[model samples]
Target: MSANKGFETKVPENEGMDSGYMSGLVSELASGPLSEPISEVGSDSGKRISVSVEEEQLDSGLDLQISEQLSNLSFKDVTPTTQPLLVDLEEHKPSIIPQLDRLFMQDDDGDTQLHIASVHGCQKSVSTLIKVCPQRAWMDVSNDYGHTALHLAVLSGHDVVTRMLVLAGASLDVRDVSGRTPLHLAVEARDERCIKSLVIPSPNTPREKMVRILNMRDYTGQTCVHYAARAGRFDIIHLLVNCGADILAGEGLAGWTALHMAARAGDAALARAILDKYGAAAAARDFAGRSPRRLAARTAAAPAFAAHRRDDTDTDSDSEDDYDSESDEQESLFEKLVQLNNPINVV
Candidate 1:
């Protein structure tokens, strides 16, 4: 009964290898699980495929979340949201957040898209903007020169745009940097359609408001009627008067009415129209106490008045002498006779 007799010595399985090398390999395998080394794991094609799949799933989840958010938001069709002169916005469909603000974004000169569209006579864009505009005040947004969309429309002689702006509730009382309103600019431009669009009362603009705008004068103290008379636009004067323009309203400095400006401009036809319509304007004296009649004598209107008097000479020979003597006396005293004494002699 000895230990040597009970346990026999066991030899290595690979008898051809060195015993030290075999011992080292056995110790390395025993130190860890029988798995690949770190370098080999990194190079595994299966591991690489799994990692790529994970990344793709993460990216797809993020895209789905963003699309859900966009679907919940209100989208506006802002396709026509650019300047018609620079770009053809009709072809592009870029989306924006709070699209109404984009329509009002001003340029370097403080002109909005509405201003550009209005000046270019882009009625389609103008209508689109007006339809989607959140507020009426946005249409009145002015440029660097204090020119609103309405001002530009009238200045550009776009009667349709002018009417559209007016119907959209653009203010007529808004004055430009020159103190000229849209109505004043229309009259100066002699744009009859634009003038009618501005002066005519609509459901949005009542008769009272139209009257107030008609009476408004520029920095030069000239109203629309005053400009019409100076330009010798008798038809415009008639239109203005019919639309309730205050012909008796005097201008700023000299207190000259439209009649006074017409007389001073030597426009007999204009002077006659104003006098016939508003007779009191003839008696209305200037700051210098010069009536329209007095102002006419020094102008070319004097010859026209004399000719008109000759035209009215009595056809009967019996009254020829009386008519000639009266005409001579009237011609001499035309400038001196006051409305108080001469009973309102219109030029």
Candidate 2:
């Protein structure tokens, strides 16, 4: 009566559209194999590193140009007695300091002398390099791998170098060739002090900017939390969450949540911490459509954890088969937990 509100309309051109065919086309366009193989990053040895040709290709414009410029320069590490030039740099005297810049060794890997000092955990060398190199040389130049000196120091677990880099005005959120920020690398190394150094704001940096960095993701769509979860770094996890990391962030490895990685990694305590704080993760589904509850059930540590609580003892069981023997009736409390965790269902 009012305006034919109950009537439905259809576009004339779409009258005979095949919905199934259209859906198949979409699936085909969306489905493809991943290009890169899985490989570990951030070596503990702090050795010189090389970038893949593929990664080199991925960087465009200015990054490529800088890589070309760095290719021509080379620096060999000099033993203290072998090179008087480097030692003379300690004076930071104006007349000799400018000459020190010409001796800049863009190592074979494209690292400046500053990068080498940072990676090797030589704080004295880093300080001297900062004092003597042209002001820009300490932080601005990245290697062929797109890793700044700060990135190298953090990845190599050089906390002293990392702290020094931060205090000297290094960018906190610089990414490497892998598109991983310093925070991501620190989380992987499980180094809490270095993690703190990167996350804490510099004197000039705004607090809000630091908050944004807390949740920044890498090329794989995984955040710093995902790396922390994988490494089972409880302290880092607590630090990140307290610093404004969103527990509900569901971006990473095939859409796998941080809870998924923690549950799979036999870290029931960390997984529970996540659930306790962000209950919604319990019902969150991964690419496989499995929620955290179902995923947690599959972990051998869950049963071991349950056993440990029942009696104050060590639970070194290698298998979860014993848990499989239990009847479906045992799952009632878990079901209730799932219901309770879903905010929509809570009374």
Candidate 3:
């Protein structure tokens, strides 16, 4: 082992590696085996490798110190000469959520630690961050598109993370730049668990403003039910309906109701569910004054259903066969509701 003698390679006067940091690393290496070879790559560019300490043998204090070094150094500068020293990856992992503020890895779009964890489905990090991070962060932190932790979690389909964020005080109704709430994202993503997490409050907890939460419309004035219908997620539609979402609620973009969305897709189970559960919406008209039945008739499924009805006319002379009379037109329209396929379990 030598002193501050031959190893002192003065860094340039301008700017480069932290001088104190470089000296400290070199001084530590001076205590190790003398025969360790220096990196050949650095030889051309004044780069020098010195450390030869056994990484795993370092105790907790050294482990943390080494972890800091690992964070600050690239492999080119810190590679071991004789044998590779494998740093314990666990020690370097950002375990504490608040530590994100000090970390160099900033999430894309300036998303707070909570948003990144939520987007990645890091449940533990999300839960901890919510509890310990500044309240203002949870309340106000949003990414470039104005998505909060809750919105990202729901959109990313992370159910546990979504619930944890909500319970930890993230706003359930926080809207994104597009004015979409977590519930809207959940519906659009068709994530059942996330939908329930956002819509259904925890047991023993008082419900959120039920009317506001379930019926809260996005910028387009469409509610969760509208998204559910469009996605053909009958279960989600049923869930929102049970939550008191209006089946006839008008969408902002086209003023189309949930029924209109269902009918446009020719999702018979959804249309039937709306009809069976809330009969008025079945006959409701959109901004274009087109009834769901009319919208439904325009769909590919509608022609398929009509074709099915026509082909089956040989066996059963249903009301469709009686459509020669105008009175049977209404009855004929009613039979257009069954489907190309029954994916939804409607009662």
Q: How close is every model to the real structure, measured as TM-score? A: 0.60, 0.56, 0.55
Q: Candidate 1, residue 212: CA error in Å?
A: 0.2
- List model 2 lDDT by residue over 168-187, tens digit each: 56777777766778888888
Candidate 1: which stretches are off by over 4 Å? Answer: 1-97, 303-347
Q: Tens-digit lDDT track for model 1 on 1-347?
A: 01112332122224333222122332232232221221112212333211111111111111111122222222122122221111111211122113435557787778776776677665555655554354567788888888998987787777766777776678999998768899999898898878877765555667777788888887767788878877899888878877778778887656778877777678887777666566666567666565666557757665543443322222222223333554445444433332223324444
Residue 164, model 1, lDDT: 71
Give the local distance difference test score of model 3.
Answer: 0.51
Give the local distance difference test score of model 2: 0.54
Give the root-mean-square deviation of each candidate in angstroms: 32.5, 22.6, 20.1
Report model 1's TM-score to 2 decimal places.
0.60
Q: What is the lDDT of residue 45 in candidate 2?
A: 66
Q: Which candidate number has the best lDDT?
A: 1
